[model samples]
Target: MSTDTQHGESSLLIQLQHGLKREQFERALHDIRAGWNRRELWMTLGLHDVRQRYRRSKLGPFWITLSMAIMVLALGLLYGQIFGQDLHDYLPFLAAGFVIWGLIASLVNDGCQSFILAEGMIRQLNAPLSIYAYRGLWSILIAFAHNIWVFLGVALWFGVDLNWNLLWVPVALLVLLLNGLWMALFLGLVSARFRDVPLIVGSVVQVLFFITPVIWKPEMLPGRALWLDLNPFYHLVEIMRAPLLGQAPALANWLPVIAITVVGWAVALFFYSAYRWRVAYWV
Candidate 1:
């Protein structure tokens, strides 16, 4: 009995010696690095998601473009009437606002749930939290591409010119992509922990729409609307819209978005690094 008891104690000591806190950190690093290497997984998964989204529909991918165009037309006409604006002048403006805001909103709304949406694959594979962030980014890219139809329709209707200023469009999109990743990283972790983020985000976004200059022109408000100067989202939207209107975006617009991005990314990196493990468990 003494020999058997000693053997049991020795076995536990061996196990404890083998299991160190350093090993836990190393394992976590490995998972994060593996995730980085498999970055393509997010792109692939995003494509699969896009395909699955319209798989059963007769129109397939075109459905996304067609649907967005329909929405822009319906909403522009309805809201322009409600606001007592000229349909011709307001339609293009409304189209630009709607499409850009849709991309931003989708990034915020779905980005939070990115990990939750990708849980099945995350479980099967050892990867980095960044992949889920990329998945959310790619999803927004797909939607934004589809939303281009709103611009085409607006241009056709109002002769909205796309000139050299339009070149800024890509730069604006890059800024948007950066913001999307940061939001996905931060919000994704929060949603995993709380499970109520989607609902709260939805309600907040709905209110934010009326507060934003989507249907109404910024000029409609006096000095108070200058408050938009402080909102990074307002600047992000303006940078995208100004070029489409063949004008340089206000220099005032650039700083806020960049500042928000710098601070947001720093916060996001820490949040993702810390909460990444909890995400796996939550999933």
Candidate 2:
């Protein structure tokens, strides 16, 4: 908070700004790039998103969690019976998946539209494109935190045991957030070039939801379990669900998930860097 510290920080950021624009990919890579107080940026952007979301509603951010719970209840009651799954066990599984999926869906849906949605601020202020994407990511995380209330409710309602595996929940969330950030950076940058990119992402999320195992269990797939390996969403859902279910994913499950997220993240950074400068003008 000292003037000296502020000056040093500004100088450092300026250096990054210069290096960032040296090429296309690096510019977008600047946000989550290591050694730049990444935690602080995440926390700051997260708070900004929360404030914006609650600014309109009197109950503010709690509404996000509340809305998420309602959706789960509605879907679980209907889909549990339709799928012939018992609501007692099924509701808890569905609750965990619902909260995590919202984070994924929001990241993709909002990432595809992050910059466009933040246009007024982008144009009026010297906002980093990554910050805009972070807003979307933060909003989802906050909502996920709120929806976690359902985790408790579901367990108690079904008389499920709260296990030590629940401690791994944060690790799973980090994986989800990392993937979400990549989606936001890559899609947000590209979508700016083609206005329809947002619409396309929206449609894909809808189509993929049915294909992915949200309403049902992965065990329902029969011999096609190998096919589930191909879905990034499946791993994402499993990462969160496994922990709460007291069956935390093995290294085999997570090694691949981490690899996939890293590769996708690198690709998105490339696109973001390649297109970051033009984003201001595009919006």
Best-performing candidate as measured by lDDT: 1
**Number of clashes found in candidate 1:** 1
Tell me how far candidate 1 lies from the true structure as C-alpha RMSD in angstroms. 7.1
Give me the displacement of residue 107 in model 1, in angstroms: 0.5
Clashes within 3 Å, all models in order? 1, 4
lDDT by residue for model 2 (189-270), tens: 8788689988988998888787778888888877767767888778777877888878856776787788989899878776
For model 1, the run of ten residues with the poorest summed lDDT? 12-21
Per-residue lDDT for 203-278 in model 1, tens only? 8888877788888888778766656666667888888988877787778888888888899987776555555666
Candidate 2: which stretches are off by over 4 Å?
1-58
TM-score of 2: 0.82
**Whole-model Cα lDDT per candidate?**
0.78, 0.77
Model 2 residue 70 lDDT score:
88
Instruction: Write down the worst ten-residue block by lDDT for model 2.
Output: 28-37
Error of 2 at 234 (Å): 0.4
